[model samples]
Target: MSEKMKKIIKIAIIASLVSSAYSVRAQEDELSNDSHVTTSFVKRQVAQNMSIGRAVKSIVSNYPQEASAVVSTALDMYPDKYQEIIHAAISAQPMLTEDIVKIALEKNIASCANIVKTAINAEPSYVDFVVTAAANSTPEELNEIVRVAVITEPDSADFIVQSLAQQHPNKIVDILSSAIEAVPLVGEYVVETLLAIFPNDAESVVSTAVRESASERANVKRIIETAQNFGLDEESIYKYAKEGGATDEEITAALSEATEQR
Candidate 1:
């Protein structure tokens, strides 16, 4: 071939190679975009089929805020599944238990009492978060929640009661009384913690403990002694104990013990 023809042929071959490379690059880019779209669509469909708990767990690591939004939406659509979803979500991401419970309480997605109870029951370790969340939105429900917590998770009762009593002192009597009434066995623990934490409220705490305890005689005697140790007057101790259902005889015996100790 002539030198000029050979040069033209070489140029044509180079152009063909460049065109092929560009076509391959364009095809790759298209495939990449298609893959992204397909992935997003698949996720959407999966979310719809699965429980909010499962869906949130799947996305919470990478998209916490998005997971939260998805959960909120799912709650709205399937209120019946609130408890189930809450358990699943919290189990999947224990770290988000507080956030999920707070949202549930603030939004009033389920019965405030039920939600708090369920959260505590589902994850007793998260009792503080559940109690705090309920206290924030529905303080009135705290009493019932405490009652349930004491019975359901007696081990956590001390912490729950102490936290609530410290945070809402005004509710101390109600909280202590409800807990003792629901789970009479917790009375001793409640009395011990309250006296230690709120010594100044000894009279009121002792009084409530006596009145609400199912084992009135034993609890009253214990309260009477604890009260006297706290420097409460025998007259006041007797009054509170008697009011709490200690018979006149029970009060006399308790006072006798106090006198002997003194």
Candidate 2:
């Protein structure tokens, strides 16, 4: 097997071996001392497709502390098991990831890139994880995140714009607006990203707003109008739409209007 597959398997094994002991206090060298910080703890478990999700869920429930190691080892040992772990990440409550994911986000994109590449290879469907990790990353790190996120999940224009607005507001607005204009179908995501900019609309409009407002303003308006449009809603729109009285038709019409604005 390839080296990447080997790492994932190791992590899956660790997930299988985890116990519910109140505490595991051992030396850094020996997991018996610290369950959250060792390679051996990961080697003892067995995570099949059926159990992999649960195992991953358990580890992520303890995220950052669990770090990229669990998924890393799992991809190494059970390459086929990566997606199961990512799905668990998606559905598992209290979303979290290995500390290495954060360290990489905080310190260097290369570090995070290595881990995310493993995730992408093992679980191609979970490319969004890379996008998400980039989104949550610090400012200097965002551009690199955006570069990778777009390459990995090109369909996620909103993620790209959001990253630009959230991280490099000064240079990003016009650039992103141009991208949105070029790809009008998903222009709403750009506008949405604009809204997400701090100081709110002021930041968003500074980009392609006034210049493109006449032609693209409607599209831009739809996404920035509501606080939720800017991702500031009390609850996620997806969940709200599920529970709210608005019908699918209503939402679709709204989206259509937004898309047709420019």
The prediction achieving the highest lDDT against the true structure is 1
lDDT of 2 by residue, 1-262 (tens): 9999999999887776674232332322343234343444554434332475676666555554454556555555555555565445544532343333443444332344454554444444445544456456654445455555445555766655664555455656554545444454455555555555654454344334423433544453343334244544433433333332334554455445544653
What is candidate 1's lDDT per residue for 45-149, written digit by digit as tens?
347756545655554543444445545655665677788767766776676777788777766777777887778767889787778777867776877878777
Name the weakest run of 10 consecutive residues (lDDT summed) in model 1: 34-43
Task: Output the number of the TM-score-best candidate.
Answer: 1
Query: What TM-score would candidate 1 get against the native?
Result: 0.70
RMSD per model, one decimal: 10.0, 15.1
Q: Which stretches of candidate 1 lie over 4 Å from their true place?
A: 1-50, 61-67, 214-216, 222-239, 251-262
How do the predictions measure up, each by TM-score?
Answer: 0.70, 0.41
lDDT at residue 239 of model 2 (Cα atoms): 35
Instruction: Report how far residue 27 has shifted in candidate 2, in Å.
Output: 15
